[model samples]
Target: MEAFWAAAVGIVWGLPLVILLAGAGVWFMLLSRAAPLRHAGHALAILSGRYERRDAPGEISHFRALSAALSGTIGMGNIAGVAIAIAMGGSGAVFWMWVAGALGMATKFFTCTLSCLYRKPDSQGVMQGGPMYYIEVGLGPRFRPLAMLFAACAMVGCLGVFQSNQLAGLMQAQWSVPAPLTGLLAMTAVGYVVLGGSVRVGRFAGLVVPLMCLLYLGGGLLVIADHAERVPAVLRAIVLGAFDVDAGIGGAAGLTVKEILVTGVRRAVFSNEAGLGTEALAHGAAQTDEPVREGLVAMLGPFIDTHLVCTMTALVILTSGVSPQAAGVVTTAQAFEASLPGLGAGLVSAIFAAFALTTMITYAYYSVKCAKYLFGERRGGAFVWIYLVLIPIAALWTPTTTVNIIDTAYALMVIPNMTATLLLAPRVLVAMRDYFARQEG
Candidate 1:
C-alpha cells in the first residue's frame, strides 16, 4: 500500500504538475503586472472592514471569508507538513516554500477575483462562486467539463484527512487518547459548526482562526527568540540548502536536487492551497460587488500560511537543534520541549488539535460546495454527512496513506483549476484594473 501511494504521489506530483503549478503563478504575476502584490496594503484594508458593505450580494463578510479560507489553509500543513518537508527535502525546502508562497499570492489574486466576477445565485438566492462557476459561467458551457472535473476532484481533495490523521496520531502518542475518541471529539465539534451552515462556519472560523494562529506563532517566536544567535545560521542554511542535493536529514535516503525542490513546492502548495481552488470557494462568498476587492483579500492566504506560519515552524525545528529526520509531530514536539521543557510540547499538542478541528469545519463547507456543484443542491446538501463520516476513518488511517490520498486528489483538482484560472485570468485582470481605476478616480 505504501509503495502504491508512493508511486501515485510521484506520478501526480511529478515535474509536469510542478511546472504547471509554478508556471501558472508566474504567468499570473506577469499578466497582472504584480498589481495584486503591489496592492496588498489595499487587501488588508478590505480585510479590516474598512470598506465593508453588508448589503452587498454575498453570504459572508470579507473578514469572515478570509478567516474561513485561512482556517482551511493554516492548519496541520504548517505543523506536520513543514516537518515532513525538512525531513525529506532539508532546510532548502523552506527556501522553495517561500518561493511557492510568493507566487501563490499572485495566483490567488487571479482566482479569487474571477470567483466574485462570475458568481451565480443558487436556488436559495445565495450567491455561489468558485473555479467551477467561473469555468462554466465565464468561459461558457463549452468549459462545463472542466468545471465538473474540478468539482469532482475537489470533493475528494478538500476532505482534511491530513489534518485529522495527524492530529489523531499526535493525541494518541502524546496523551494516549484513543484515535477513535479523538476522531469522535473532532467530528462532534466540526459537525456542530458545519451543520449550522456557511454562516456558522464563517462565524466560528472568524473567531477561532486568529486565536489559533496567535497561539502557535507566539510559541514558535519565543523559541526562536531564545536561540537568537542561531537564527542567522539557520537562515543561511535554508538558502544554501536550496541548491544542495545532499541537504536534509534524509540525505542518506538518496534524494536529489529535483526531489528536494519538488518536496518543498509540494508541501508549500499543500499548506497554502493557492491554485487548488479551495480559496476561491471561500472568497467567492464574500459580500462585495468589486471582485478585485476580494481578490486582494484572498492574496494574503499563502503569505500567512506558508511564509509566516510554516517559516515559524521551520525555524523552531532548526534552532532547537532537533533532527528533521524525526517523525513529523515528534520533531516539532521535541523542538518545543527542548526550548520550554514541559510546557511547550503540551501547548503544541493542544494547538494542533484546535488547528485540526477548525480545519475540518472549514473544509466541510468546501466539500459541500463541491458536492452541490456535482449532485445539484437538493442531493448535494446531504453529502455533508458523508464528509462527517470520513473524519473518523481518516483518523485511523496511517499518515502516509492519508497524505497520499489527499495529495493525489489535490494534484487532480489543481489541473482543472489552474487550467481554468489561466484561461479566465484576462477577465479578472480587466476587473482588477477597472476597480483600481475607479478607486483612483
Candidate 2:
C-alpha cells in the first residue's frame, strides 16, 4: 500500500503539475499587476471589517470566512507537513515553500474572487459558492462537466483524513493512548461541532483559529529566541540548500535542488491549499458584496499559514539541530522541548490538538459543500456522518498512506480548478480593474 501510494503521488505530483501550479500562480500575479503584493494593506483593512456590509449576499462575515479557511489550511500542514518536507527534501525545501507561498497569495486572490463572483443559490435557497459553482455559473453550463469533476474529487479530498490520522498518531506518541480510542474521541469531538453545519463551523473557527495561531506562534517564538545565535546560519543553509547542485550536498542534511523544489511546492500546496479550491468554499460564504474585497482578504491565508506559521516550524526544527530524518511531529516536539524543556512538548501537543480539531471541523464544512454540490442539499447531511465515520478509519491508516491519498486527491481537484481559474482569468482581471478604480476614485 505504501509503495502504491508513493507511486501514485509521484505520478500525480510530477513536473507538469508543478509547472502548472507554479506557472499559473506567476501568471495570475502578473495578470493582476501584483495586486496581492501591492494592495496587501487593503486586504488587511477588509479583514478588519473596514468594508463590511450588514446585508451582503453571503452567510458569514469576511473575518469568519477567513477564519474558517485558515482553520483548514493552517493546521497540520504548517507543523507536520513542513517537517515532512524538511525530512524528505531537506532544509532547502523551506526556501521553495516560501516561493510557493508568495505565488499562492496571488492564486488565492483570483480563485477566491471568482468563487464569490459566481456564487449560486442552492435548492434550499441558501447562497452556495465554490469551484463547482464558479465553474458552472461563471463559465456557463457548457463547463458543468468540469464542475462536477471538481466537486466529485473535493468530496474525497476535503475529508481531513491527513489531519485525523496525524492527530491520532500524535496522541499515541504523546500520551501512549491507543489509536482506536484516540480516533473515537476525535470523531466525537469533530462530529459534535460539525453537525451544526457552516454557521457553527464559521463561528467556532473565528473564535479558535486566532487563539491557536497565537499560542503556537508564541511557543515557536520562544524556541527561536533561545537559539537566536543559530538563526543566521539556519537561514543561510536554507537558501544555499535550495539551489545546491550536489546530490549529496553538505547543508540541510543533503538535498538537491530538484528534491528541494518538489517537496517544498507539494508541502506548500498542502499547507495553504492555494490552488486546490478547498478554501474558496469557505471564502465563498463571506458576507460581502465585493468579490475583490473577499479575494484580497483570502490572499492573506498563504502568508499567514506558510510564511508565518510554517516558517516558525522550520526555524525551530533547523535551529534545534534535530536530525533531518526524524519523524514529522517528533522532530518539532524535540525542537520545542529543547527550548522550554518540560513545558514545550506539552504546549505543542495542545496546539496540535487544537489545530487538528479545527481543521477537521472546517474540512467537514468543505466536504458538506462539495456533497451538496454533487448530491443536493438534503443529501449533504449524510456526508457529515460519512465524514465522521471516516475519521476512525483514517486513524487506522499509516501516515504515508494518508498523506499520499490526500495529495493525490488534491492533485486531481487542482486540475479542473486551475483550468477553470485560468479560463476565467480575464473576468477576474476586469473585476480587479473596476474595483480598484472605484476605490481610487
Candidate 3:
C-alpha cells in the first residue's frame, strides 16, 4: 500500500502537472491585470459586508463562505505542511511557496468568479455551484464528462484524512492519547456540524476561524519576537536556498532545485488550495448576486493561508535549529517548544485541535457537495456517514502514506479544474471589466 501510494503521488505530482498548475496561475494573473493584488483592500471590504445583499440568491453570507473555505485551507497545512516542505526541499522551498501563493491569488479570483457566475439549482432546488457546475454551464454540456471527473476525484481528495492523521499523531505525541480515541472524538465533532448542512458549517466557521487564526498567529508572533535577531539570517537562507543547486545538508543532498520548486508549489497548492477547486464549493454558496465580488473576496485565501500563516511556521522551524530531517507536525511542535519552553507543545496542540476539527467539518461539506452532484441530494446524507467513518480509518495510517494519498488525489482534481478554468477565462475577464466599471461609475 505504501509503495503504491508513493508511486501514485510521484506520477500525479510530476513536472507536467506542476507546470500546468503554475502556468495556469500565471496566465490568470496576467489576464486579470493582477486584480487580486491591486484590489486587495476592496476584497476585504466585500468580506466586511460592504456589498452585502440580504435578498441575494444564495445560502450564506460572503464572510461565512470565505470562513468555511478558509477553515479547509488554513488547518494542518499551515502547521505541518510547511514543515514538510522545508524538511524535504530545504528552506529555499519556502521562497517557491511564496511564488505559488502570489500567483494563486489570480487563480482563485478567476475560478471562484466562474463558480458564482454559473451556479445551478440542485434536485431539491438549492443553488449549487462549483467547478463542476461552471464547466457544464459555462463551457456547455459537451464538457460535463470533465465536470464529473472533477467531482469523482474531489470525493476522495477532500476526505480530511491528512488533517485527521496529523491531529491524531499530535494527540499521541503531546498527551499519549491513543489514535483510535482521537479519531473517534474527531469524527464525532465533525459529524455534528456537517450533518447540519452548510448554514451550520458557515456559522461555525465564521466564529471559529478568526479565533484560531488569532491564537496561532499570536503564538507564532511571540516566537518570532523572541528570536528577532535570527530573522534576517533565516530569510537569507530561504532566498539563497531557493536557487542553490548543491546546498543540501546531511541526508538532503539529493534535493535539487527542481525538487525544491516541486515541493514548494505542491505544498502551497495543498496549503491554500488555489487550483484544487475545492474551495469553490464553499465560496459558491455565498449570498450575493455579484460573482466578481465573491471572486475578489476568494482571492485573499492564499495570501492568508500560505503567505502569512505558512511563512510563520517556516520561520519557527528554520530558526529553532531543528534538523531538516525532522518532518511534519512533530517538527513544528519541536519549534514551538524550543521557542516558548513549557507552553509551546501544549499551545500548538490546542491550535492544531481547532484547526483540524474545523478542516474536517468544512471538508465534509465539500465531499457531500460532490456526492450530491454525482448521486443527487437525497443521497448526500449517505456520503456524510461514509465520510465520518473514514476519519477513524485515516487516523490509523502513517503520515507519509496519508500525505501521498491526498497529494495524488488533489493533483488529479487540478487537471480538469484548471483545464475548465482556462477554457472559460474570457467570461471571467468580461465580468471583471463590467464589475469594476460599475463600481467606478
Candidate 4:
C-alpha cells in the first residue's frame, strides 16, 4: 500500500514540475518580452514599495505575505536540498539554481497577480485564493475537480510530509534526537496554530519569519567569515562547474554538466516555488486592490529565498572544505561546526525547528483556504486532522521515504495548478500590461 501510494505520488508530483516550471518559465520569459529580466530594476524598486503604500486591500500587508511564503520555501531546501544537490550533482548546481531564480521572477509575478484577481470568499466566508482558485474560477466549473485535487495534494505535501522531513532531519543531525520524538513535538506545536485558522497563521508568520531569517543568516555569516580565504576559489569552482561538460565530481556517474543544470533548476523551483502557485494563497490574502502591486511584492520572494538565504547555505557548505557527496547533512553541520565548534549542529537544528514550524503554520493557511473552498467548513476540520496526524508519521520515516512522499505530493498539486496557470497566462499578461502601462503614464 505504501509503495502504491508512493508510485501514485511520484507520477503526479514528478511530471508536472518539468512541464510547468521549466516549460512555463521558458514561455513567460519570451511572452513578457523578458519582463522579469528587462525590468529587473523595476521589480526590485517595486519590492521596496517605492510605488505603492502599505495601505493596500485584502487582509495582511505585502511584507507579511512574502515573509509567510519565504518561511515555507526557505526552510529545509536552503539546508538539505542544497546539501543533496551539491553532494550528488556538484557545486555547479548552485549556478543553475541562480538561473532558476532569475527566470522564476516572471513566473511568480503572473501567478500571484492572477491569485488576487480570481480570489473570493469561501464557504466559510474567509478570503481564499491559490492555484485552486485560478483552476476553478479562471478555468471555470469544467476544471473544479482538478482544483480540488491540487488543494488536497498541497495540504498533504506542505503541511504534512515536507515539514515532518525538515524537523526530523534537523533533529537527527543536530542533537541526535530520534525522528519520532521530533516529529511528535513538531506535530503538537503545529496543531496549535493550524486550529486557529488563517488569521492566526498570518500573525504567527509575521513574527516568526523575521526572527528565524536573522538567526539563520547570522549563523551562516559567522561560518562564511571564518572561511574568507576559500571564498574566491569556491565561487570560481561553482562558475566553472556550471558549464563543464565533463563529469568532475563522481566521475562518469557522478555529476555531468547537464545533470547539474537540470537538478539545480529543479531544486531552485522546489526551493522558491515561484511558478508553482502555492504561495499565491498567502499573497492573495493581502488587503490590496491593485493586483499588480501584490505581484511586484511577490517577485521579491525568490530573491529572499534563493538569492539571499539559499546563497548563504550554498557558500557555507561549499567553502567548509567538507564533501557533501560523502555525508549530506553532516557535511553541512560540519561547515557550521568548523566555525562554532560544539554548537554548530545544535544551532542548525534549532534553525531547522523554526523553519519547519513556520512552514507548517504558513502552509496550513494555504491548505485551509482551499479546504473551505472545496468542502466548506464541515469537512475542513477532518482534512486538518488528517494532516496534523501525518506530521509525526512523516518525521518517523527515513529521509528517503519523507522526500519521496513530498516529491509525489508536490507533483500532484502542481499538475492542476500549472495547467490552470497556462490556460490563464493570457489573463496574467493582459493584467501586467494594463497595470504597467498605467504606472508608466
Candidate 5:
C-alpha cells in the first residue's frame, strides 16, 4: 500500500513540473512583466514592513504568515533536498535550483494573491484561504469535488506522510533513534501546537524560523570560512560540470540542458513549495486586506528556503569534498559530518530534526485549514487526530516507501490545485494591479 501510494504521489507531484509549472511559469513571467526579477528590491522592501498598514484584515500579521510558510519550506529541503540535488543532478543542480526559485516567485504571487481574494471567514470568523477555498469558490459548485480531493490529499499526503518521514529521517540519523520512537516524540511536539490552532502554529513558526535559520546559517558559514580557499574551485567545478559534454549525462538516455533545468526547477519547487500553492495555504491567513501585501511577504519564502539555506547545504557538501553518491538523507549527513568532523554530523542532525519538526507542525496547520474548508471545523479535529496518530507508523517504515507515497500524494493534490490557480489567476492579477494602483495613489 505504501509503495503504491508513493508511486502515485510521486507521479502526481512530479508531473506538474513538466506541465503545470513549466507552462504557468513561462506565462506568468510574461504576464507579471517579470516583476519577480525586475522589481525584486521592491519585494524585499515590502517584506521588511516598509509598506505595512495598520488597517489590515485577516487573523495574524503578514510577517507571521510568511514566517509560518517559511518555517514549513525551509526545513529538510534546505538541508537534505540540496544534498539529494547535488548527488543526483550534480553541482549544476544548485544553479537550476536558483532558476526554479526565481520562477517560483511569480508562481507564489499569482497563487497567494488569489488565495486572499477568494478568502472567506470561517465559522469562528477566522479568515480562511488556500487551494481548497479557491477551488470551491473560484470554480463554483461544479468544481467542489476537486477542492475536496485536494484537501484530503494535503491532509494525509503532506501533513501526515512527508512531514513524519523527513522528521523521522533526521532523528534516526542523528541519535540512531528508532523511527517509531522519534516519530512519536516529534508528533507529540507537533500536536501541542497544532491542536491549539493557527494562532499557536503561526506564533511557533514566527519564533522558530528566524532562530533556526540564523543558527544553521552561522554554522554553515563557519565551515565555509575554514574552506575559503576552495570556494573558487568549487564554483568552477559546478559551472563546468553543468556544461560537461563528456560527463556521461548525454549519450544513453542521459541528462540534457532541458532535463537538468527541468529537474532542478521541479525539485526546488517541491523543496520550497513556493508556486505549488501549498505555502499560500499558510500565508493566506495573514491579517491583510491587500493581497499584494501578503504576496510580497510570500515571496521571501523561496529566497530563504532555496537561496540562503539551500546554498549553505550546497557549499558544505561541495567544500567538504563529500561524495554526493549516497541516497536518502545520508547525503546531507555525510556532507555535514565530513566538514565539521565529530561535531558536524551531530550538529547537522540536530538542525535537521529541528527543521523537520517545525515544518511538519506548520504543515499540519495548513492541512487542517484545508480539511476545515472541505469538511467542517468540527471535522478538522478528527482529521488532525488521525494524522497525528499515523506519524509514528510512517516513520518506522522504509524511507523509499514513505517518501514515494508522500511525493505521489503531493503530486495528486497539486494537479487540481494548479488548475484552479491557473483558471483564477487573472482574478489575482487584476486584484494585484488594482491594489498597487490604489496604493500608488
Candidate 6:
C-alpha cells in the first residue's frame, strides 16, 4: 500500500501537474492584478470582526472560519513539511515556497469568491458551500461529476494522516510515548470536537489557532535569535538555492531546478493549501453573503501559514545547529532541542500537539462536509465514527506513506477544483470589481 501510494504520487504529481498548479496560481494572480494583495488591509479588517453580521446566512463568524481554515493548513505541514523540503530540495526550496505563497493568495481569492457566489443550503438547511456547490451550481448541473469528484477526493485528502504520523512520530521518539497511545488521545480529543460539526471545530480552531501559532512562533524566534549570526548565511542559501539547477541535498543530490521548484511548490501547497479548494470549504461557512469578502479573507491563509509559519520553521531548522536530516518531526524536535537544551523536546512536543490536534479536528470538519456532499447527512454521519477510527490507524503509518496518500488525494482534488475555478474565473472577476467599487463608493 505504501509503495503503491508513493508510485501514485510520482505519477500524478509530475512536472505537468506542478506547472498546472503553480501556473494556475500565477495566472490567477496576474489576471486579478494581485487584487488580493492590494486589499489585504481590508481583508484584515474583515477578519478582525469589523464586518460581521449577526443575522448573516452562514454558520460561523469570519474569525472562526478563517481560524478553522488556518488550523488545517498551519499544522504538521508548516513544521514537518518545511523540514522535508529543506532536507530533500536543499535550502533553496524555501525560495519556491515564497513564490507558491504569493501565487496561492490569488488562487484563494478567486476560488473562495466563487464559493460564496454559488453557495446553497444542504439537507440540514445550513448554507453550505465549497468546490462542489460552486462547481455544480455556478457551472450548471451538467458539471455535477466534477463536483462529485471534488467531494469524493476531499473525503480522503482531508483525513490528515500526515499530521497524525508526524506528531505521533515525534512523541514516540522524544518521550517514548507509544504511537497507539498518542493516537487514542488524538482520536478522543478530535472526536469530541468533530462530533459537534463545523461550528464546534471552528470554535476550537478559533481558540487554539491563535495560541498555538503564538507559542510556536515565540519558541521559533528564541532559537533563531540564539543563532542570529547564522541567519544571513541561511537566508542566502535559501535565495541562491531557489535558482540552482542542482539544488538538492543529502540523498536528493543531482536534482534539477525543476525538481526543486516542484518540491517547494508541492510542500507549500500541502502547507497552506492555496489551490487545493479546502480553503473554500472553511470560508464557505463564514457568516457573510459577500463572496469577494470571504475570498479576500481566505487569501490570508497562505500568507500566514506558508510565508510566516513555514518560513519560521525553515529558519529554525537551518539555524539550530542540527544536521539537516530527513527525519520529519524528529528532525524538527532535534532542532528545538539543540537550542533550548533541557527544555527543547518537551516544548516542541507541546507545540506540535497543539498544532496537530487543531489540524486533525479542522480536517475532520472538511472530511465530514465532503461526506455529507457525497452520501448525505444521515449516512454521512457514519463517516465521523469511521474518521475517528482512522486516527490511531494513521498514527501507525510512516510519514512517507501518509504523505504520499495525502499528495495523491490532494492531486485528485485539484483537478476538479481548478477546472471549476478556472472555468468560472470571469464571474469572480466581475464580483471582485463590483465589490471593490462598492467599497470605494
- In the range 151-224, model 4's lDDT, one tens digit per residue, is 77776566557667767877787678899888888777777877876656777887888788888889988988
Which pairs of residues have clashing backbones in candidate 3? none
Candidate 2, 75-99: lDDT as tens digits: 6546777877777777788889999
lDDT (C-alpha, whole model) for all candidates: 0.84, 0.84, 0.84, 0.74, 0.73, 0.84
> lDDT (0-100) at residue 377 of candidate 5?
83
Clashing pairs in 5: 6-404, 6-405, 9-407, 9-408, 9-409, 10-408, 12-411, 13-411
Q: Which 10 consecutive residues of model 3 have the lowest summed lDDT?
A: 245-254
TM-score for each predicted model, relative to the true structure: 0.89, 0.89, 0.89, 0.86, 0.87, 0.89
Instruction: Give the C-alpha miss distance for residue 388 in model 2, angstroms.
Output: 2.0
Q: Which segments of model 2 are wrong by more than 4 Å?
A: 1-6, 84-92, 236-263, 321-330, 396-407
| lDDT of the structure predicted as candidate 5 | 0.73
lDDT, model 1, position 249: 42
| Candidate 1 stretches greater than 4 Å from native | 1-7, 87-90, 160-162, 240-263, 322-330, 393-407
- For 1-441, candidate 6 gives per-residue lDDT tens digits of 878998999988776776787899999988999988999999999999898888888888888988888887776546778877877787788899999998988999998888889999998799998999999999999999989999998998888687788779878887899999999999999999988877888898899898888888888898889889988887877887788644423223677777787888988866776777888999899889788999998888889998889899888877765344544333666777877898977887787778888888888888999999999989997999988888898899646776788778877888999999999998999999999999999
Number of backbone-clashing residue pairs for each candidate, in the order shown:
1, 0, 0, 9, 8, 0
Off by over 4 Å in 6: 1-6, 87-90, 160-162, 232-237, 240-262, 321-331, 396-407
lDDT of 4 at 295: 74
Worst lDDT 10-window in candidate 5 = 245-254
Worst 10 residues of 2 by lDDT: 245-254
Once fitted onto the true fold, the runs of candidate 5 whose alpha carbons sit more than 4 angstroms away are 1-7, 13-16, 53-55, 176-181, 236-255, 322-332, 395-405
Better of 4 and 5 by TM-score: 5
